[model samples]
Target: MKFIAHINIMPKTELLDPQGKVVVKNLPNLGIQGVSDVRIGKHVTIALEAPSEQEAHDKVELACSKLLANVIMESYDFVIEAQ
Candidate 1:
Protein backbone atom coordinates (compact mmCIF):
# COMPACT_ATOMS: atom_id res chain seq x y z
CA MET A 1 0.00 0.00 0.00
CA LYS A 2 1.02 3.61 -0.57
CA PHE A 3 0.39 6.32 1.98
CA ILE A 4 0.72 10.05 2.09
CA ALA A 5 1.89 11.51 5.33
CA HIS A 6 1.35 15.13 6.24
CA ILE A 7 3.44 16.23 9.18
CA ASN A 8 3.47 19.39 11.21
CA ILE A 9 6.34 20.30 13.50
CA MET A 10 6.13 23.07 16.03
CA PRO A 11 7.93 24.37 19.02
CA LYS A 12 6.46 23.64 22.42
CA THR A 13 4.11 26.28 23.80
CA GLU A 14 6.44 26.90 26.70
CA LEU A 15 9.17 27.94 24.30
CA LEU A 16 9.45 31.29 22.59
CA ASP A 17 8.88 31.54 18.85
CA PRO A 18 10.74 34.61 17.69
CA GLN A 19 9.69 34.28 14.07
CA GLY A 20 6.03 33.83 14.95
CA LYS A 21 6.18 36.72 17.34
CA VAL A 22 7.61 38.95 14.64
CA VAL A 23 4.88 37.99 12.24
CA VAL A 24 2.19 38.60 14.81
CA LYS A 25 3.58 42.05 15.57
CA ASN A 26 3.69 42.93 11.90
CA LEU A 27 0.13 41.81 11.23
CA PRO A 28 -1.38 44.87 12.96
CA ASN A 29 0.77 47.15 10.85
CA LEU A 30 -0.65 45.52 7.76
CA GLY A 31 -4.20 46.35 8.95
CA ILE A 32 -4.77 42.85 10.26
CA GLN A 33 -5.55 43.20 13.91
CA GLY A 34 -6.99 41.15 16.76
CA VAL A 35 -4.57 38.34 16.08
CA SER A 36 -2.18 37.41 18.84
CA ASP A 37 -0.08 34.59 20.22
CA VAL A 38 0.81 33.35 16.77
CA ARG A 39 3.28 30.51 16.57
CA ILE A 40 5.10 29.34 13.48
CA GLY A 41 5.49 25.74 12.46
CA LYS A 42 6.74 23.55 9.62
CA HIS A 43 4.88 21.25 7.30
CA VAL A 44 6.30 18.18 5.62
CA THR A 45 4.84 15.79 3.09
CA ILE A 46 6.10 12.26 2.62
CA ALA A 47 5.01 9.34 0.48
CA LEU A 48 5.68 5.96 2.00
CA GLU A 49 5.23 2.32 1.14
CA ALA A 50 3.56 0.40 3.90
CA PRO A 51 1.26 -2.54 4.33
CA SER A 52 -1.39 -0.70 6.30
CA GLU A 53 -2.38 2.62 7.78
CA GLN A 54 -1.01 1.63 11.15
CA GLU A 55 2.35 0.80 9.61
CA ALA A 56 2.49 4.10 7.82
CA HIS A 57 1.68 5.93 11.01
CA ASP A 58 4.41 4.10 12.87
CA LYS A 59 6.94 4.89 10.23
CA VAL A 60 6.07 8.57 10.21
CA GLU A 61 6.17 8.76 13.98
CA LEU A 62 9.60 7.20 14.09
CA ALA A 63 10.89 9.58 11.49
CA CYS A 64 9.48 12.57 13.34
CA SER A 65 10.91 11.45 16.66
CA LYS A 66 14.35 10.66 15.31
CA LEU A 67 15.02 13.26 12.63
CA LEU A 68 12.17 15.54 11.74
CA ALA A 69 11.60 17.17 15.13
CA ASN A 70 13.57 18.06 18.24
CA VAL A 71 11.74 16.05 20.87
CA ILE A 72 13.04 18.23 23.69
CA MET A 73 11.69 21.51 22.33
CA GLU A 74 9.35 20.56 19.52
CA SER A 75 6.31 18.38 18.95
CA TYR A 76 4.92 16.79 15.83
CA ASP A 77 1.66 15.46 14.42
CA PHE A 78 0.95 13.47 11.29
CA VAL A 79 -1.98 12.27 9.26
CA ILE A 80 -1.74 9.23 7.05
CA GLU A 81 -3.98 8.78 4.05
CA ALA A 82 -4.17 6.24 1.30
CA GLN A 83 -2.59 7.31 -1.92
Candidate 2:
Protein backbone atom coordinates (compact mmCIF):
# COMPACT_ATOMS: atom_id res chain seq x y z
CA MET A 1 0.00 0.00 0.00
CA LYS A 2 1.05 3.57 -0.68
CA PHE A 3 0.49 6.34 1.82
CA ILE A 4 0.79 10.11 1.65
CA ALA A 5 1.55 12.07 4.76
CA HIS A 6 0.87 15.72 5.36
CA ILE A 7 2.87 17.06 8.28
CA ASN A 8 2.86 20.36 10.08
CA ILE A 9 5.74 21.49 12.26
CA MET A 10 5.56 24.51 14.51
CA PRO A 11 7.64 26.19 17.13
CA LYS A 12 6.55 25.51 20.65
CA THR A 13 4.21 28.11 22.12
CA GLU A 14 6.62 28.78 24.95
CA LEU A 15 9.29 29.77 22.46
CA LEU A 16 9.45 33.05 20.59
CA ASP A 17 9.09 32.90 16.82
CA PRO A 18 11.37 35.58 15.43
CA GLN A 19 10.16 35.19 11.86
CA GLY A 20 6.52 35.46 12.87
CA LYS A 21 7.31 38.47 15.01
CA VAL A 22 9.07 40.17 12.13
CA VAL A 23 6.15 39.54 9.86
CA VAL A 24 3.69 40.87 12.41
CA LYS A 25 5.79 44.00 12.88
CA ASN A 26 5.93 44.64 9.16
CA LEU A 27 2.25 43.96 8.54
CA PRO A 28 1.28 47.23 10.20
CA ASN A 29 3.69 49.07 7.92
CA LEU A 30 1.82 47.68 4.94
CA GLY A 31 -1.45 49.09 6.32
CA ILE A 32 -2.55 45.74 7.62
CA GLN A 33 -4.23 45.78 11.00
CA GLY A 34 -6.42 43.90 13.44
CA VAL A 35 -3.97 41.00 13.52
CA SER A 36 -2.41 40.80 16.91
CA ASP A 37 0.10 38.03 16.28
CA VAL A 38 1.48 35.54 13.80
CA ARG A 39 3.33 32.27 13.92
CA ILE A 40 5.33 30.70 11.13
CA GLY A 41 5.48 26.95 10.62
CA LYS A 42 6.47 24.30 8.11
CA HIS A 43 4.32 21.95 6.10
CA VAL A 44 5.77 18.74 4.70
CA THR A 45 4.36 16.08 2.42
CA ILE A 46 5.83 12.62 1.98
CA ALA A 47 4.84 9.54 0.04
CA LEU A 48 5.92 6.10 1.09
CA GLU A 49 5.05 2.45 0.81
CA ALA A 50 3.74 0.48 3.78
CA PRO A 51 1.95 -2.77 4.38
CA SER A 52 -0.68 -1.30 6.68
CA GLU A 53 -2.02 1.98 8.01
CA GLN A 54 -0.51 1.30 11.39
CA GLU A 55 2.88 0.77 9.83
CA ALA A 56 2.56 4.00 7.89
CA HIS A 57 1.63 5.88 11.01
CA ASP A 58 4.59 4.50 12.90
CA LYS A 59 6.97 5.27 10.08
CA VAL A 60 5.77 8.85 9.81
CA GLU A 61 6.02 9.34 13.55
CA LEU A 62 9.56 7.98 13.62
CA ALA A 63 10.56 10.21 10.75
CA CYS A 64 9.12 13.25 12.46
CA SER A 65 10.78 12.48 15.76
CA LYS A 66 14.14 11.53 14.34
CA LEU A 67 14.69 13.96 11.51
CA LEU A 68 11.81 16.18 10.45
CA ALA A 69 11.10 18.08 13.66
CA ASN A 70 13.11 19.38 16.56
CA VAL A 71 11.58 17.67 19.56
CA ILE A 72 12.80 20.29 22.00
CA MET A 73 11.76 23.43 20.13
CA GLU A 74 9.18 22.24 17.64
CA SER A 75 6.08 20.06 17.79
CA TYR A 76 4.67 18.14 14.85
CA ASP A 77 1.46 16.52 13.69
CA PHE A 78 0.76 14.41 10.62
CA VAL A 79 -2.09 12.76 8.78
CA ILE A 80 -1.61 9.77 6.51
CA GLU A 81 -3.96 8.78 3.73
CA ALA A 82 -4.05 6.05 1.14
CA GLN A 83 -2.59 7.13 -2.14
Candidate 3:
Protein backbone atom coordinates (compact mmCIF):
# COMPACT_ATOMS: atom_id res chain seq x y z
CA MET A 1 0.00 0.00 0.00
CA LYS A 2 1.09 3.56 -0.66
CA PHE A 3 0.74 6.21 2.00
CA ILE A 4 1.16 9.92 2.29
CA ALA A 5 2.45 11.22 5.57
CA HIS A 6 2.08 14.82 6.62
CA ILE A 7 4.30 15.70 9.50
CA ASN A 8 4.56 18.82 11.59
CA ILE A 9 7.27 19.58 14.10
CA MET A 10 7.20 22.51 16.49
CA PRO A 11 8.99 23.88 19.46
CA LYS A 12 7.64 23.00 22.86
CA THR A 13 5.28 25.50 24.50
CA GLU A 14 7.82 26.38 27.18
CA LEU A 15 10.29 27.32 24.45
CA LEU A 16 10.33 30.73 22.79
CA ASP A 17 9.54 31.08 19.09
CA PRO A 18 11.08 34.32 17.88
CA GLN A 19 9.87 33.92 14.31
CA GLY A 20 6.30 33.15 15.31
CA LYS A 21 6.28 36.08 17.71
CA VAL A 22 7.45 38.41 14.98
CA VAL A 23 4.76 37.18 12.63
CA VAL A 24 2.09 37.51 15.29
CA LYS A 25 3.16 41.04 16.14
CA ASN A 26 3.16 42.09 12.53
CA LEU A 27 -0.04 40.37 11.48
CA PRO A 28 -2.23 43.22 12.72
CA ASN A 29 -0.33 45.65 10.56
CA LEU A 30 -1.01 43.39 7.60
CA GLY A 31 -4.77 43.59 8.41
CA ILE A 32 -4.76 40.16 9.95
CA GLN A 33 -5.65 40.42 13.59
CA GLY A 34 -7.19 38.48 16.44
CA VAL A 35 -4.76 35.69 15.72
CA SER A 36 -3.16 34.99 19.04
CA ASP A 37 -0.63 32.47 20.20
CA VAL A 38 0.81 31.62 16.80
CA ARG A 39 3.70 29.22 16.79
CA ILE A 40 5.95 28.29 13.87
CA GLY A 41 6.66 24.75 12.83
CA LYS A 42 8.04 22.58 10.05
CA HIS A 43 5.96 20.50 7.68
CA VAL A 44 7.17 17.39 5.91
CA THR A 45 5.48 15.29 3.29
CA ILE A 46 6.48 11.68 2.93
CA ALA A 47 5.49 9.15 0.31
CA LEU A 48 6.19 5.56 1.17
CA GLU A 49 5.08 1.99 0.72
CA ALA A 50 3.87 0.14 3.78
CA PRO A 51 2.02 -3.01 4.54
CA SER A 52 -0.62 -1.28 6.63
CA GLU A 53 -1.66 2.04 8.08
CA GLN A 54 -0.10 1.14 11.38
CA GLU A 55 3.17 0.36 9.65
CA ALA A 56 3.12 3.64 7.81
CA HIS A 57 2.44 5.52 11.01
CA ASP A 58 5.24 3.72 12.78
CA LYS A 59 7.67 4.54 9.99
CA VAL A 60 6.75 8.18 10.08
CA GLU A 61 7.05 8.27 13.86
CA LEU A 62 10.44 6.71 13.68
CA ALA A 63 11.56 9.18 11.07
CA CYS A 64 10.39 12.06 13.22
CA SER A 65 12.17 10.72 16.25
CA LYS A 66 15.37 10.00 14.39
CA LEU A 67 15.70 13.02 12.13
CA LEU A 68 12.66 15.19 11.68
CA ALA A 69 12.41 16.63 15.18
CA ASN A 70 14.45 17.33 18.25
CA VAL A 71 12.73 15.25 20.90
CA ILE A 72 14.15 17.32 23.75
CA MET A 73 12.86 20.72 22.61
CA GLU A 74 10.36 19.89 19.90
CA SER A 75 7.29 17.74 19.41
CA TYR A 76 5.85 16.16 16.29
CA ASP A 77 2.47 15.16 14.90
CA PHE A 78 1.56 13.37 11.69
CA VAL A 79 -1.35 12.15 9.64
CA ILE A 80 -1.23 9.17 7.36
CA GLU A 81 -3.50 8.82 4.36
CA ALA A 82 -3.86 6.42 1.51
CA GLN A 83 -2.37 7.64 -1.69
Candidate 4:
Protein backbone atom coordinates (compact mmCIF):
# COMPACT_ATOMS: atom_id res chain seq x y z
CA MET A 1 0.00 0.00 0.00
CA LYS A 2 1.01 3.60 -0.47
CA PHE A 3 0.10 6.62 1.61
CA ILE A 4 0.34 10.36 1.20
CA ALA A 5 0.92 12.57 4.18
CA HIS A 6 0.01 16.19 4.64
CA ILE A 7 1.96 17.73 7.50
CA ASN A 8 1.85 21.05 9.24
CA ILE A 9 4.65 22.42 11.41
CA MET A 10 4.18 25.43 13.60
CA PRO A 11 5.90 27.28 16.36
CA LYS A 12 4.66 26.49 19.85
CA THR A 13 2.19 28.96 21.31
CA GLU A 14 4.54 29.79 24.14
CA LEU A 15 7.17 30.72 21.56
CA LEU A 16 7.26 33.91 19.55
CA ASP A 17 7.11 33.77 15.76
CA PRO A 18 9.27 36.56 14.38
CA GLN A 19 8.11 36.20 10.78
CA GLY A 20 4.46 36.08 11.77
CA LYS A 21 4.94 39.08 13.99
CA VAL A 22 6.55 40.97 11.14
CA VAL A 23 3.60 40.24 8.90
CA VAL A 24 1.12 41.29 11.58
CA LYS A 25 2.95 44.52 12.24
CA ASN A 26 2.82 45.43 8.56
CA LEU A 27 -0.81 44.49 8.12
CA PRO A 28 -2.14 47.89 9.07
CA ASN A 29 -0.15 49.55 6.32
CA LEU A 30 -1.91 47.31 3.83
CA GLY A 31 -5.29 48.40 5.27
CA ILE A 32 -5.77 45.09 7.00
CA GLN A 33 -7.08 45.45 10.51
CA GLY A 34 -8.31 43.49 13.48
CA VAL A 35 -6.05 40.54 12.75
CA SER A 36 -3.77 39.79 15.65
CA ASP A 37 -1.62 37.05 17.12
CA VAL A 38 -0.72 35.69 13.73
CA ARG A 39 1.61 32.73 13.58
CA ILE A 40 3.27 31.35 10.49
CA GLY A 41 3.84 27.69 9.80
CA LYS A 42 4.94 25.19 7.14
CA HIS A 43 3.17 22.51 5.16
CA VAL A 44 4.86 19.34 3.94
CA THR A 45 3.70 16.54 1.70
CA ILE A 46 5.20 13.09 1.45
CA ALA A 47 4.24 9.88 -0.35
CA LEU A 48 5.57 6.54 0.81
CA GLU A 49 4.82 2.84 0.99
CA ALA A 50 3.16 1.39 4.06
CA PRO A 51 1.13 -1.64 5.01
CA SER A 52 -1.48 0.22 7.04
CA GLU A 53 -2.69 3.69 7.82
CA GLN A 54 -1.56 3.40 11.42
CA GLU A 55 1.86 2.35 10.32
CA ALA A 56 2.05 5.23 7.89
CA HIS A 57 1.05 7.60 10.66
CA ASP A 58 3.74 6.23 12.88
CA LYS A 59 6.36 6.69 10.18
CA VAL A 60 5.31 10.25 9.56
CA GLU A 61 5.40 10.96 13.28
CA LEU A 62 8.93 9.62 13.45
CA ALA A 63 9.95 11.83 10.53
CA CYS A 64 8.38 14.82 12.18
CA SER A 65 10.04 14.17 15.50
CA LYS A 66 13.43 13.28 14.10
CA LEU A 67 13.78 15.61 11.11
CA LEU A 68 10.79 17.62 9.96
CA ALA A 69 9.92 19.58 13.07
CA ASN A 70 11.90 21.10 15.88
CA VAL A 71 10.51 19.37 18.94
CA ILE A 72 11.79 22.02 21.30
CA MET A 73 10.05 25.04 19.77
CA GLU A 74 7.69 23.58 17.19
CA SER A 75 4.76 21.18 17.04
CA TYR A 76 3.32 19.19 14.14
CA ASP A 77 0.23 17.38 12.89
CA PHE A 78 -0.41 15.18 9.89
CA VAL A 79 -3.10 13.48 7.86
CA ILE A 80 -2.53 10.23 6.06
CA GLU A 81 -4.55 9.07 3.06
CA ALA A 82 -4.35 6.32 0.52
CA GLN A 83 -3.06 7.12 -2.91
Candidate 5:
Protein backbone atom coordinates (compact mmCIF):
# COMPACT_ATOMS: atom_id res chain seq x y z
CA MET A 1 0.00 0.00 0.00
CA LYS A 2 1.08 3.54 -0.64
CA PHE A 3 0.50 6.20 1.95
CA ILE A 4 0.93 9.95 2.01
CA ALA A 5 1.64 11.75 5.22
CA HIS A 6 0.96 15.41 5.77
CA ILE A 7 2.94 16.78 8.67
CA ASN A 8 2.93 20.04 10.54
CA ILE A 9 5.74 21.22 12.77
CA MET A 10 5.36 24.19 15.04
CA PRO A 11 7.13 25.87 17.88
CA LYS A 12 5.82 24.90 21.30
CA THR A 13 3.12 27.33 22.39
CA GLU A 14 5.05 28.09 25.55
CA LEU A 15 8.04 29.25 23.53
CA LEU A 16 8.38 32.60 21.83
CA ASP A 17 8.26 32.68 18.05
CA PRO A 18 10.53 35.53 17.09
CA GLN A 19 9.78 35.41 13.37
CA GLY A 20 6.04 35.29 13.93
CA LYS A 21 6.27 38.18 16.34
CA VAL A 22 8.24 40.21 13.80
CA VAL A 23 5.52 39.68 11.25
CA VAL A 24 2.80 40.61 13.72
CA LYS A 25 4.63 43.77 14.68
CA ASN A 26 5.02 44.85 11.06
CA LEU A 27 1.55 43.95 9.80
CA PRO A 28 0.23 47.38 10.78
CA ASN A 29 2.74 48.98 8.44
CA LEU A 30 1.13 47.26 5.50
CA GLY A 31 -2.29 48.55 6.62
CA ILE A 32 -3.14 45.18 8.08
CA GLN A 33 -4.88 45.22 11.42
CA GLY A 34 -6.96 43.19 13.87
CA VAL A 35 -4.44 40.37 13.83
CA SER A 36 -2.96 40.02 17.23
CA ASP A 37 -0.57 37.11 16.69
CA VAL A 38 1.20 34.93 14.16
CA ARG A 39 3.22 31.78 14.28
CA ILE A 40 5.40 30.31 11.57
CA GLY A 41 5.70 26.60 11.06
CA LYS A 42 6.68 23.92 8.57
CA HIS A 43 4.57 21.57 6.52
CA VAL A 44 6.02 18.35 5.18
CA THR A 45 4.64 15.71 2.90
CA ILE A 46 6.04 12.21 2.74
CA ALA A 47 5.04 9.36 0.48
CA LEU A 48 5.96 5.84 1.41
CA GLU A 49 4.95 2.24 1.08
CA ALA A 50 3.43 0.53 4.07
CA PRO A 51 1.31 -2.50 4.74
CA SER A 52 -1.10 -0.66 6.97
CA GLU A 53 -2.17 2.81 7.99
CA GLN A 54 -0.78 2.26 11.46
CA GLU A 55 2.60 1.48 10.04
CA ALA A 56 2.60 4.57 7.89
CA HIS A 57 1.64 6.72 10.81
CA ASP A 58 4.40 5.27 12.96
CA LYS A 59 6.97 5.89 10.28
CA VAL A 60 5.92 9.49 9.88
CA GLU A 61 5.98 10.00 13.63
CA LEU A 62 9.49 8.62 13.77
CA ALA A 63 10.63 10.87 10.99
CA CYS A 64 9.18 13.90 12.69
CA SER A 65 10.65 13.11 16.08
CA LYS A 66 14.05 12.03 14.81
CA LEU A 67 14.77 14.42 11.98
CA LEU A 68 12.01 16.79 10.90
CA ALA A 69 11.16 18.49 14.17
CA ASN A 70 13.03 19.56 17.27
CA VAL A 71 11.32 17.68 20.06
CA ILE A 72 12.42 20.11 22.74
CA MET A 73 11.40 23.28 20.96
CA GLU A 74 8.74 22.11 18.55
CA SER A 75 5.71 19.85 18.37
CA TYR A 76 4.41 17.87 15.44
CA ASP A 77 1.41 15.94 14.16
CA PHE A 78 0.63 14.12 10.96
CA VAL A 79 -2.19 12.55 9.03
CA ILE A 80 -1.76 9.51 6.89
CA GLU A 81 -3.93 8.80 3.89
CA ALA A 82 -4.04 6.23 1.14
CA GLN A 83 -2.52 7.48 -2.05
Candidate 6:
Protein backbone atom coordinates (compact mmCIF):
# COMPACT_ATOMS: atom_id res chain seq x y z
CA MET A 1 0.00 0.00 0.00
CA LYS A 2 1.09 3.51 -0.61
CA PHE A 3 0.37 6.36 1.75
CA ILE A 4 0.86 10.10 1.84
CA ALA A 5 1.47 11.81 5.13
CA HIS A 6 0.73 15.43 5.91
CA ILE A 7 2.67 16.74 8.87
CA ASN A 8 2.55 19.94 10.83
CA ILE A 9 5.41 21.07 13.05
CA MET A 10 4.99 23.91 15.47
CA PRO A 11 6.72 25.40 18.44
CA LYS A 12 5.37 24.19 21.72
CA THR A 13 2.68 26.46 23.07
CA GLU A 14 4.58 26.97 26.28
CA LEU A 15 7.56 28.18 24.27
CA LEU A 16 7.99 31.67 22.88
CA ASP A 17 7.44 32.20 19.16
CA PRO A 18 9.33 35.37 18.36
CA GLN A 19 8.38 35.29 14.70
CA GLY A 20 4.72 34.90 15.52
CA LYS A 21 4.91 37.69 18.07
CA VAL A 22 6.52 39.99 15.56
CA VAL A 23 3.74 39.32 13.10
CA VAL A 24 1.10 39.87 15.74
CA LYS A 25 2.63 43.18 16.75
CA ASN A 26 3.03 44.33 13.18
CA LEU A 27 -0.45 43.38 12.08
CA PRO A 28 -1.90 46.43 13.79
CA ASN A 29 0.78 48.60 12.29
CA LEU A 30 -0.18 47.27 8.86
CA GLY A 31 -3.70 48.48 9.60
CA ILE A 32 -4.88 44.97 10.39
CA GLN A 33 -6.26 45.14 13.88
CA GLY A 34 -7.84 42.55 16.16
CA VAL A 35 -5.35 39.95 15.00
CA SER A 36 -3.64 38.31 17.95
CA ASP A 37 -1.72 35.25 19.03
CA VAL A 38 -0.15 34.57 15.70
CA ARG A 39 1.95 31.46 15.23
CA ILE A 40 4.27 30.18 12.54
CA GLY A 41 4.88 26.57 11.69
CA LYS A 42 6.02 24.20 8.98
CA HIS A 43 4.12 21.74 6.86
CA VAL A 44 5.60 18.60 5.35
CA THR A 45 4.29 15.94 3.04
CA ILE A 46 5.85 12.53 2.47
CA ALA A 47 4.95 9.65 0.22
CA LEU A 48 5.91 6.11 1.16
CA GLU A 49 5.03 2.49 0.71
CA ALA A 50 3.92 0.50 3.73
CA PRO A 51 2.16 -2.73 4.48
CA SER A 52 -0.58 -1.04 6.42
CA GLU A 53 -1.84 2.33 7.53
CA GLN A 54 -0.55 1.67 11.04
CA GLU A 55 2.88 0.92 9.68
CA ALA A 56 2.85 4.09 7.61
CA HIS A 57 1.84 6.11 10.63
CA ASP A 58 4.63 4.62 12.72
CA LYS A 59 7.21 5.32 10.07
CA VAL A 60 6.08 8.91 9.73
CA GLU A 61 6.14 9.30 13.49
CA LEU A 62 9.71 8.08 13.55
CA ALA A 63 10.61 10.49 10.78
CA CYS A 64 9.10 13.35 12.72
CA SER A 65 10.93 12.37 15.90
CA LYS A 66 14.25 11.69 14.25
CA LEU A 67 14.42 14.44 11.64
CA LEU A 68 11.37 16.50 10.91
CA ALA A 69 10.73 18.10 14.25
CA ASN A 70 12.69 19.08 17.35
CA VAL A 71 10.81 17.41 20.15
CA ILE A 72 12.37 19.67 22.78
CA MET A 73 10.96 22.90 21.35
CA GLU A 74 8.48 21.74 18.72
CA SER A 75 5.56 19.34 18.52
CA TYR A 76 4.22 17.46 15.52
CA ASP A 77 1.22 15.56 14.26
CA PHE A 78 0.41 13.84 10.99
CA VAL A 79 -2.39 12.33 8.98
CA ILE A 80 -1.91 9.48 6.56
CA GLU A 81 -4.12 8.87 3.55
CA ALA A 82 -4.07 6.48 0.66
CA GLN A 83 -2.73 7.82 -2.57
Task: Give the per-residue lDDT of model 1 (tens digit) for 1-83.
Answer: 99999999999999999999999989988899899789999999999999899989999999999999998999999899898
TM-score of each: 0.95, 0.95, 0.89, 0.94, 0.95, 0.93
For 1-83, candidate 4 gives per-residue lDDT tens digits of: 99999999999999989999999999999999998879999999999999899999999999999999998999999999899
Question: Over the stretch 32-83, how does candidate 5's per-residue lDDT look in tens digits?
Answer: 9999989999999999999999998888988999999998999998888898
Write model 6 residue lDDT over 19-76, tens digit each, in one string: 9999999998779989869989999999999999999999999999999999999999
Q: After aligning candidate 1 to the native by TM-score, how far in Å is the CA of 21 from where it should be?
A: 0.7
lDDT for model 5: 0.94
The superposed Cα distance between candidate 1 and the true structure at residue 29, in angstroms, equals 1.6
Backbone clashes, each candidate = 0, 0, 0, 0, 0, 0
User: Which ten residues in a row are the worst by lDDT in model 6?
Assistant: 27-36
| Residue 54 C-alpha lDDT in model 2 | 97
- Report the Cα lDDT for residue 47, model 4: 96
- For each candidate, C-alpha RMSD in Å? 0.8, 0.8, 1.2, 0.8, 0.8, 1.0
Report the error of model 4 at residue 53, Å.
0.9
Clashing pairs in 1: none
- lDDT, residue 33, model 3: 72
Worst 10 residues of 3 by lDDT: 29-38
- The C-alpha lDDT values of all candidates are 0.94, 0.96, 0.94, 0.95, 0.94, 0.96
Off by over 4 Å in 2: none
**Residue 12 accuracy (lDDT) in model 6:** 97
Stretches of candidate 4 above 4 Å error? none
Q: Between the candidate structures 2 and 5, which one is better when assessed by lDDT?
A: 2
